[model samples]
Target: MYQPLAYRLRPKTLEDIVGQEHLVGPGKIIRRMVEANLLSSMILYGPPGTGKTSIASAIAGSTSFAFRMLNAATDTKKDLQIVAEEAKMSGTVILLLDEVHRLDKTKQDFLLPHLENGRIILIGATTENPYISINPAIRSRTQIFEVHPLTPEAIEMALDRALTAKDGFKDEDVILEQSAKRELAFVTNGDLRSALNALELAVRSTPKNEDGTILITKEIIQECTQQKGFSHDKNGDAHYDVISAFQKSIRGSDADAALHYLARLIEAGDLISICRRLLVIGYEDIGLANPAAASRTLDAVLAAERLGLPEARIPLSVAVLDLCLSPKSNSAYQSLDRALQDVKNGKATTIPNHLKDSHYKGAAALGRGLTYQYPHEFSDGWVAQQYLPDPLAHTRYYEPKFTGRYEQALAKRYEELHQKKSSSTK
Candidate 1:
């Protein structure tokens, strides 16, 4: 059976792994474990194509242990039993369990005792957070290490190696242009497997030149990657991460960074998410400080909805730029949160009698609106009177933040009313 370039080029030792120096580098915990021949069951969590399986295979190779592969979601208990039997025969085995978070009770029970006795060194690999997704029983039995996405530099190094490695296209006259290599590395977004797959596709599909060399160019890579440069999986962790970065970039007042994230979301065709998050950022991050910017954000969102994608990005970009440059303040919502907390805590919450409705004849008889003072009846359209419940009459919640001209005026009016109330009380 023909193997993929990625599978064929799998690193056989810790030293040969492309990224994850913290785990596979010299003197690291994993490298140390292999060096001492004292292996243990561990879970490796990270985004796909970041060397989790490679690490498992390398460990098995380095230790000369029996290596077996199985998918926790798809493999049956019988398959696990086969590995267990092999472990008993060989004394030990390194098992790479993919999507280990999906391990069912049946398979887990069968594997537990083997793991405990060190008969099978379990290397559980997952793209999900082990703490949140894996069972506590399994989690407690293994040390968890996070694998990070490979950096562009690390991916470039891997691409360079693949062009000449024996298991790669070394024998073929595959002339990968420097720019093409960078493009492949850039488009894959730190996924070495994706880069290798694209590289293989480009090499096989492109016709050879007169000199008998398969010339891979930037155009060829772009075609092979199919505009995967801004690939986004809407149901994956990266979706939330990108949205978080998008909002944070706007909150940090970095228009360039905000637009970059916006572009990624645009490529994903996620106009609704873009609109929703921008609307939230307007109120949550830029409230009161630049209310006009918030209003314009709404307008841009409306325009985006009317126009749909491609052109929608224009209004979205305008809104993002406006928000990124707006004066930021969360005090408006923060004050409401304080008041909400008081309500949730069940603090004294009876409505003051004077502030209650007095429109009905029976309301006056019930002591409603008896001492109420209408602010509009005063000369300045303002008056000092109790509005809060008795227990919270003196409590303060709306602490104004004067981050912009508009909020500065609001703060002035707020202080004026506070002073008048104090004087009235005296």
Candidate 2:
């Protein structure tokens, strides 16, 4: 059973690590802790394959501590007990708990004391934000450091290491062209594991010459990775970046760029994410200007969900196109934020007595709904009335954009009503 290239080529020492200079670099927090042998319980937070596990393994390598790993979901209390017993005699056990955020109550309670003291030096790795997912008690005890996506330069370094290292392809007699190498780095985005796997696929699948010299070109690399070769890392930065691009492109009304990003996500085959993002873009960016477009986008998303992949992309693309071509207006989004901000800042205003609910047992004796005119009784079905809080009575919140007919109509109606109210007051 051969290990995956990423696993086999994992850095044995902290120095061999590829990225995350903020943590692993000389004099950084991790390096300093390692140097002083004061390694404390900590959490390595980041996107997958950004070297969280590798860093944990490297810590054991560097410190000569007994290393043991267990999945938070599957490992039993008995298994943890075994590690604890081993640690008591072996000095300290470096425990690498994958998906530590998923740790159950039984195991969590058992590990608490061990983690608090020096018996079990815990290194938990999670792709999800620990602050949101992990137990607060456990979180408070450990130092948290974020592992960022590998830069292209760092990915290139990892590739070079894989090609030349003894544990990697050093003895394979393969010639990877510089252009091909760069393509692998670029296609993998910031995921070195993805690059290594693609490299492994290219090297193993492609034929060698009579002399056993394997020549890997950019075309061969592309073929191995299926050309698109992207590692979206679902919850990662790349995923967020694509979503951001899809939204901004549509908001800027650049149908071409928006479609390109749509194709990228479609190629990734994440219908759920694509569907969710499309709906958000429709409402947040194309609101007011094309309110109906948001509903249509929802319809398209439903269609895509039912149809699934390739076929689903059609409806998604339709929604994307409609949103891009529609008049763009973020005014509604801004207005809501402004009103919410005022509320958050403690700008208190009591609800007007006239507007208070009058349907309750309390009658006109308390003047709960006094002077509240019923607009429906008026011939025009309109009346000059104050519905806002007393302090906010004259504080206008909605500023409809004039880019579309619906909002422009709203603006006009609002202006007329305000003018009439003002004249009546005078």
TM-score, one value per model = 0.84, 0.77
Q: Which candidate is the best by TM-score?
A: 1
Q: List model 1 lDDT by residue over 1-426, tens digit each.
A: 999999999989887899999998988999999999999999998888999999999998898899999999999999999999999999999999999999999999999999999999999999888888899989988999999989989999998898899999889989888899888888888889999999999998999999999999999999999975666887666788899999999999999999999999999999999999999999999999999998999999999999998999999999999999999999899999999999999985889889888999799889998998887888999877888888988898999998888889999998998988999899
lDDT digits (tens) for residues 1-426 of candidate 2 = 989999998777899999999998999999898889989999998877789999999888899799999999888999999999999899899999998888999999999999877899999998877878899989999999889878888898888888898889999998999999889888876777888999999999989999999999999998887756554556544676788898889989999999999888887777888898888888899888879999999999999999998899889888999999999888898998989998998876788788878887865677889889999999989888888777777888888789999889878998988899999878
lDDT of each: 0.92, 0.88
Q: Lowest-scoring 10 consecutive residues by lDDT in candidate 2?
A: 229-238
Candidate maximizing lDDT: 1
Model 2, C-alpha of 336: deviation from truth (Å)? 5.4
lDDT over C-alpha atoms for residue 164 of model 2: 92
> What range of 10 consecutive residues in model 1 has the weakest lDDT sum?
228-237
